[model samples]
Target: MDHLTALENKSIFIIREAYFRFRNIAMLWSVGKDSTTLLWLVRKAFFGVVPFPVIHIDTTYKFPEMYRFRDEYAKKWGLNLIVGRNEGQVEAGMGPGKGTKLDCCNELKTNALKQIIEKNGFKALLLGIRRDEHGIRAKERVFSPRDENFKWDYENQPAELWDQYKSTAAEDNHFRVHPILHMTELDIWKYMKKENIPLTELYVSKNGKRYRSIGCAPCCSPIDSTASNVDEIIAELESTHTSERAGRAQDKEDAYTMQKLRSLGYM
Candidate 1:
């Protein structure tokens, strides 16, 4: 099989395995290129039917385009979409502009996810996280476990070799299943193009700027680029030396901000 085909096959296998192993599970959809591609793969894995709920941890600060794209696609695809939000925090005036980005993320994103997961009693969550995206994510396993507090102990991780994974954990522990951990930024774009996966046009350049990474509107900024099409984006990825998340503001708050964020259950 070709490289892309191999990746696709492995991801499908992982998705199937996660569904079979975890009786109650959900998938996180960030409405970004990677997660949308992942959602597409989930459909293919289950023969055009996703078997579980799709959750979006809404910070309520995302761009209007993102909200529109999410609502439109969620309806069009017939997804069992569940939007999670920390209404109390938002009412209490927690946001990117109010305090440190770390604090805001913890309040809006992490705690919001915690509420939904516990309320729904989800045993596992399929997240679209790639190892190459950031240094902290490189330490993640295909099935990483989190405690009741949603804290990850990165110091101890099980080994997986030759498609064998140790996904066993305490009954109360939550598993974060990463099917696309092996796909890089370039691989994702190529797969999106090959599969005709639809993404929000925010990634496409407008006025010589485009969002390389999509997140909360206040935390994410646009990059200087003119790559409006998928083909042009692939070419840019091949030639550019810039990091994919160079425009993300929360990541720059501290030297280990990403680590801290992920450790506390930030996606």
Candidate 2:
């Protein structure tokens, strides 16, 4: 098989394994390239049908285009999309503008996700986090476990070699399956283009500016770029020196900001 086929096969196998092992599981869709790619993989895994619900934590500050794209695609594809939000915090006038990036992420994104997981009793979450995304993500396993408090134990991650992944975990520990951990950013865009996957328009250049990463609208900024299409984006990633997460404000506030937020159950 070619590289793309091999990646798809591995992801399909992992998704099936997670479905068979976990009683209650769901997939998290951030409406970004990675998660959207994973969403396509899920449909492929189950013969063009996704059995689990796709979760999206709406911070209420996301780019307007994100919601529009999300709703449009979800309906078009017949997706079981579950949107979660912390209405209480939003009503209390809480947002990124009121406090530090860490604090804002905690209230707007992390806490909202935790509540959704608990409310739905999801025993496993399939995330599209890749090892190449960052140093912290590099330490994650194909099937990592998190405690009831959503604390990721990086030191105690399970081992997987030659396609054998460990999917079982204790009662209070939830499994996190990373199907595309080994795929690079280039591989994702290639697969998306090859599969003709629908994506948000925000990634396309708008008046010489385009977002490299999508997050809370107030916190995520666009990088200076001229890439207007998938082909141009692929070329940009090949020559770009900036990190993929550089456009993310929370990541730049401190070296350990991601680790700290993730430790508190942030995705």
Candidate 3:
């Protein structure tokens, strides 16, 4: 009945519900603290075995450490790891450096995710997105649906009053289930502490700098922090006034960048 336990139990219920409601489902593993925590919740829900695939939409621009952490955990946890990429775009010189942040994200990250989901016929995808992470994400539902074109009708999304959720989606598209949507950034770190979750050193400070949010290396900057461990991070978060994604470059591209991206089916 405590705070952390309550969060865990709800997340477990959501994970299991998504699994049973959509048998052809997968979870996104961003190799970040949030998504990694989602992976932990999956194991807890299914009793040590993740019954579905876990996806990493590799833009081919991520930090080398991220890739190493991904591979290590995928094997250590025995995950069916599916690496998603838009090889053609990558080859055609589509990237944050060559184009606008929105364009780059759509081509490399959003389109890549869309292609993989369609190719694999995933009826539902469990994302570790939390509302507290971004302003646009605050508009998300526990069970959000997309059209065949991978477009989200954010304005007309089905309401989820109380615990009721609209899990139904069209035959040609899928649902994006947010199991950890209700959890906050601090909640994630606290859960990590309680669960003894392992994190990549990228989150830990080295030379008074640590990444608060990680994406492709080119777009992710480090914050000034000396919080080298989970306990220190939790303590820092208590007194810090920084946004969780202050290091992400994409959000700074435009005031409505994230909203537009989500509308276009970006995760």
Among the numbered candidates, top TM-score falls to 1
- Sort the predicted structures by lDDT, highest score first: 1, 3, 2
Any residue pairs clashing in model 3, and if so which? none
Clash tally, candidates in order: 0, 0, 0
Candidate 1 versus truth, CA RMSD in Å, comes to 5.7
Q: Estimate each model's TM-score.
A: 0.93, 0.91, 0.92
Q: Name model 2 segments beyond 4 Å from true.
A: 249-267
Superposition TM-score, candidate 1 onto the true structure:
0.93
- Lowest lDDT 10-mer window, candidate 3? 246-255
Please report the TM-score between candidate 2 and the true structure: 0.91
User: Best by lDDT, which number?
Assistant: 1
lDDT of 1 by residue, 139-207 (tens): 999999999998889999887878887778897899999999999999999999888899899999999
Q: Rate the local accuracy (lDDT) of all candidates.
A: 0.92, 0.87, 0.91
Q: Model 2 lDDT vs. the true structure?
A: 0.87
**Candidate 3's residue-wise lDDT over 159-197, tens digit each?**
899788888766786999999999999999999999999
